[model samples]
Target: MQAQTMQAQTMQHKRCMATVNKSRSMMRTYLSDEGVPLSYSRKRRIAMNLLKEYIREKYSSNEEIQEKLLETLSVYFNQVDNILQKTESPIEKTMAIELLNLIKSDSELGEIGFVDLEPQKTIKLNNRNKYYVADFLITWKPTVSVNGVERKLIVECDGHDFHEKTKEQVKKGKLRDRKLFLEGYTVFHFTGSEIYEDVSGCAIEVLEMIRSWHLSWVHG
Candidate 1:
């Protein structure tokens, strides 16, 4: 079983490398012709141009349809997951359980927990055009960061199944966390003991950490 898991991970690595090569090739193609690497914003601007043209032509008669299409595109291009979409996850249950704990400890922390149904992470990896799921992905209101991008808090419950026990595992975990950090995500790892001892305290710690981080851009 361990062998199979290793094999699967190897295959995933190969596929990811292939994708990265393909992306780099495309970028080189544009750079060779246009003398500039096709940046993400430029690509999105071109896509928006094409999409707007298509919508204008396709829905020429219905201004309402055009308006809606533009609205959808605007939202999609600008943001990621909608936190208020009634998501259910471990954090939601924790919120319920910790609801009372925080109230007893601190009124501010009490409002966090499961009330904010932290959805799975939506990671944009350089090698893969996919989202890597985290246990919980929370966006605090007043979410924008110093770089004008939305900040996110990724809560990971580390267990034997998903955490580092070996040296290689530790390296892999750190690389993953570094990638997440590069993309404006703050990651917090909690052991079973921590969560078991004080569920509300853990939740409150995450809330406060993220809150302090958000405030730091302006205040700090």
Candidate 2:
């Protein structure tokens, strides 16, 4: 996709128009850029009115009201993009790259590096065609044992799924985690808050788990 089109699609998927407008307003305040105080509630009401106008315009085939809503959305999203770009932190970028590289390496994890361990990395665990994306996957080449038998080192990653919808959804997530565990996979889970608050600590915990697995395989 063209860069602008891809960006638009990403924004559409990541945020609703209402959220865009609200965040844009908050960002403007943070930046102290020149802008009037925009009330989220009022803006939402205006959007509802616009929707009404849209229906009327559609029945009359006027298209003007529909064009207006599109224009408003475009401007709102642009503001949100600018605000986010300005406020974006380098730590998030660095951490993402660091975490990704840590996962890719074959070195034993320390208190610093963790890998995504979801079996989808070694086998198709999730029927999603896409492998399960996790924080770490630890695996060892099949090794010969003292009895001349072979073994496969296990891989597992820590997963944190925020924004689980309802109670049922949370229950389903637990079931899925249980199923993954039953399939000879180890699963570690954290919340987004934990990641943000104590990233280093979380990384350390993951590394310890991976190292333990490695040591057991070598000594077993």
Candidate 3:
């Protein structure tokens, strides 16, 4: 089994290399003959000739960049898994989620686990191509009845900016929350000071949302 796994990995690496090469070749072709600044009078004659020459000389069929990107991705994924296992903080975990599923791992080795349906994630919207990356996510387990069936929350660790530019930041945050609502996620933002001042209160609010979700699920 170990031997077969190694063989499969090797085959995958080779296929990745081939794909990298093909993409690199195509990019070079596009970049090389795309365009050039030209003199007014000699523009017509030189443009096509220069473009052809540029394409021929500058375009090299190489997989160097592709190979580098693949290598970097592999390294990042490995590091991300390492960090996830090592850290206990909610903030770190949130950052990892923000990075998304670009990280790849071998499932057979137990590198991945099932994630239960929890708070919404930083989902991309094709229309705006934007998503929220909150500091923490919570869910309502069926047993704990509170806000509704499921509720999503966004917690922002507000800094000095939140106080200094209070009005502006609040406006922007509300706008962001509005966008999140439109995207089907409930957002609850809190400042760092608020958390520090009323840690228990913050905890209660989170629990209340969970219970609310649970109760909704029960009633419906």
TM-score per candidate, chains pooled: 0.45, 0.38, 0.39
TM-score of candidate 3 relative to the true fold: 0.39
Q: Which of 1 and 3 is ahead in TM-score?
A: 1
Candidate 1 lDDT over residue span 144-209, tens digit each: 323453457787776565456999988988988998887778888887567656665787786677
Instruction: Give candidate 3 misplaced runs (Cα > 4 Å).
Output: 1-121, 141-150, 161-168
Judging by lDDT, tell me the better candidate of 1 and 2. 1
Residue-level lDDT of model 2, residues 59-94, one tens digit each, is 356455445545654565443333234322323222
| Top candidate (TM-score) | 1
The segments of candidate 1 whose C-alpha lies over 4 angstroms from its true place after superposition are: 1-116, 126-130, 143-149, 217-220
| Candidate 3 local Cα displacement, residue 105, angstroms | 31
Span of 10 residues, lowest total lDDT, candidate 3: 106-115
In candidate 3, what are the lDDT values of residues 161-216, reduced to their tens digit?
33326688679777877887786666666555564455445545654565465456
**lDDT of predicted model 1:** 0.55
Q: Is candidate 1 or candidate 2 better by TM-score?
A: 1
Q: Write out the backbone clash pairs for model 1.
A: 95-114
The 10-residue segment with the lowest total lDDT in model 1: 25-34
Count of backbone collisions within predicted model 2? 11
